[model samples]
Target chain A: MNLLLLHPDQRLDGDRWRLDDRQATHVRSVLKLAEGDHCRAGLLDEGTGQAVIESIKNNEIEISFKVDSKPVFALPLNLLLALPRPKMLKRLLVDAASLGIKNIVLVNAAKVDKSYWQTPNLKGDLLREKLLLGLEQAGDPVMPRLRLAPRFRPFVEDELDQWAGPGRRLVAHPGPFPELPRGLDEPATLAIGPEGGWTPFEVALLEQQGFGCHRFGSRILRVETALPALVGALMRLP
Target chain B: MNLLLLHPDQRLDGDRWRLDDRQATHVRSVLKLAEGDHCRAGLLDEGTGQAVIESIKNNEIEISFKVDSKPVFALPLNLLLALPRPKMLKRLLVDAASLGIKNIVLVNAAKVDKSYWQTPNLKGDLLREKLLLGLEQAGDPVMPRLRLAPRFRPFVEDELDQWAGPGRRLVAHPGPFPELPRGLDEPATLAIGPEGGWTPFEVALLEQQGFGCHRFGSRILRVETALPALVGALMRLP
Candidate 1:
């Protein structure tokens, strides 16, 4: 963990906080930090700062922190992704969060397996746990918002228009579609489909809603790989 | 498996081949191909074509193939990566291969764990297995070339200069380094450090060998995420 993340409630008195959970274990073991040593720390959804070890006990450690930096800014792009398999979902969540994506909509797709939504990884606590790990990795304090849309059509026709707002809407599809536009000046909502890609009807539905199909060459990358590639490419726009 | 990858020795006669290994199982179960059914197929380091199922039995399947298309071209980029942990290495290999990175140099760094070099995943057969999976995913026939440099100093002093050639040489580091140059018209080599990043000495050594430091902002991405992100961003040049 690059940042030691502490929840709001973990504060003790004015800048001083005590951690006894995994963070404490990590501080004591992995970091092997002793009194007077400093480590990067952040309060969840608050800000980042430095934390100096004050005291170390058997199971907990006390530290004093200073909040000096604002939370990492969120990206201008929102993501619309087909719900991946359970294992992939975990990694995608962490990656998406680490990449500074603040809003994510995991919707159903034609090729998405129905069983994926049933995985325990979708539970709120479990999801937050993974996102926290991502936040810690990126040294960010704010958590990305996640919304689940098990139905593809209704969500697209009803919610996506408003959620996407005034932005370039692009769907990642493999075909002879045009390359991603350069210098994307406006915000964007990028839709990534399932492993086999969106069906014709799905693509048409999205296109009707102003989603332009963008192809990243012919290589079919896994969703985890594609997410970063597409995000990175889009972020590089001018 | 997106493409059915066949070994050169798997060919039986003119335009015909038989398989009873994992590929056969994948064809029979995962792809569920029946007699007269066609699937995408490619010969290792050769070309891509279509394979039509001729017969299917419990353990083996026979097929007729045609070589029609050349392998997907390799990217005009080489990668120098500080070796990642074992589990990450597996995914990195697949991601690197799928992204069309043909030449990769996995070098040791001060932050790299020595045990990473001892992973069974580094075994030739296992590494090729992962790379094949990546090639199949991309429907590309060419296998990426991988070189392992367990010793850091010697490799940099004696080999990296020649391997990197006369292209844009860049090291991905965090700090005041300038953003990656745009419109990269020539071939380039990108060096990415391990999780903790390259030590000052290591970066200086690489700098001495003509690698310019480039920073991709402040986000600390895992090697798996960073690889695709950096590759994607670099590929977007021009």
Candidate 2:
């Protein structure tokens, strides 16, 4: 964990904060911090600063913070992704969140397996847990907003206009089309399809919505590999 | 499976070839091919074309081929990587091979665990299996060349000049240095460090060998996530 992320409610009396088992174990074992030692810490969606270990008790670590109140590293792009298998879903969610992508809409596609939507990972706590792990790895305080779109057609036709950040729209498909131009000037909304890729009808549907079709290359990458690659290629890295 | 990959030795008669269990199962269940059906197929490092299914026996499938000779999509970059944990090693080998990276040298660093050098994944057959899976996913016929550098100093001092592809040399370090300048003009050699990153001594040793330090961004991405991201950011995709 790059950052010792503390939730707002974890605040005890005054500047003191209490950490749960997860963060406590990380601090104790990974960071190998002792009483009176300070580790890089942050508040959820608040700011990044330092935390001094005050005490280590049963299942919790008490820390006193010195923080500056502001969010760190919110990515400009919003993602529209086809739900992958359960295992892949876990990895992508964590990776995408770590990349600081501001928003994600996991939508259904013709190539997506019907049972993928039934996974427990779609539930609240499990989903939030993955995002939190990502946030901690990034040392970022802001949580990327996540939404689910189980039905493909209605989501694109009805909700997509409302969903997309105001910018260019693109779809990652099997292509000899133009490359995703580097360093997009505005926030872009990119739609990535599932394993078999979008059907012709699905691609046409997205095209009707102004989602320009493109490919990174002819080599079809796994969704887990493609997201970061596409993200890095689409934006200018700081 | 994107391509039905065949070994040249599998050819049994004038136009007939036999498939092992892996390919036979993929053809029978995944591709659902029957007699007289053709699938996209290729011979190892030889060429890509099509194969016609002749019959399915107990453990093998017989086929006839018409292949065109040439390797597809060898990436114009050589990678100097720090070996990750076993599970991650599996994914990266597959992904890197699939991306068409032509050469990889897995090197050691202070932060790399000694046990990582001892993984069964370091052995020959399992390592080749991962690369073949990646090649099949990409529908590419060429296998990437891989080398191991268990000793850091000797490899960079004695072998690096001969190992490096002639052009710009880079090391992916935590940086405010500069973005990996987009699309290099010639073949390039890029080195990536271990999880906690290269120690200053390691970086300095590399710098002496003309490896310029660079970063993708401020975000600390996983080795798996970072490889594809770095690869995508460094090269212009087709």
Best by DockQ: 2
Cα lDDT tens digits for candidate 2, A53-148: 999876578999967757655778889999999898888988888888879999999989999988887897898888888888888877889999
User: What is the alpha-carbon lDDT for the whole of candidate 1?
Assistant: 0.87
Interface RMSD of 2: 1.4
lDDT score for residue B37 of model 2: 97
Model 2 chain B weakest lDDT span, ten residues long: B177-186
Model 2 share of native interface contacts = 0.59
Task: Give the worst 10-residue stretch by lDDT in candidate 2 chain A.
Answer: A66-75
What is candidate 1's CA lDDT for residue A206?
96
Cα lDDT of model 1 by residue, B99-192, tens digit: 8888999999999988889888888898888888888888888998899999999999999999989888999888888886643446999999
Instruction: Report the Cα lDDT for residue B4, model 1.
Output: 86
Residues A1-238 of candidate 1: C-alpha lDDT, one tens digit per residue: 9999988788899989998589989988899999999999998888999999999888679999978998855777889999999999999999988888888999999899999988888899998888888888988888988899999999999988999988899998877888876434368999999999999999999998899998876688888889988887777522
The lDDT of each candidate is 0.87, 0.85
C-alpha TM-score for every candidate: 0.96, 0.96
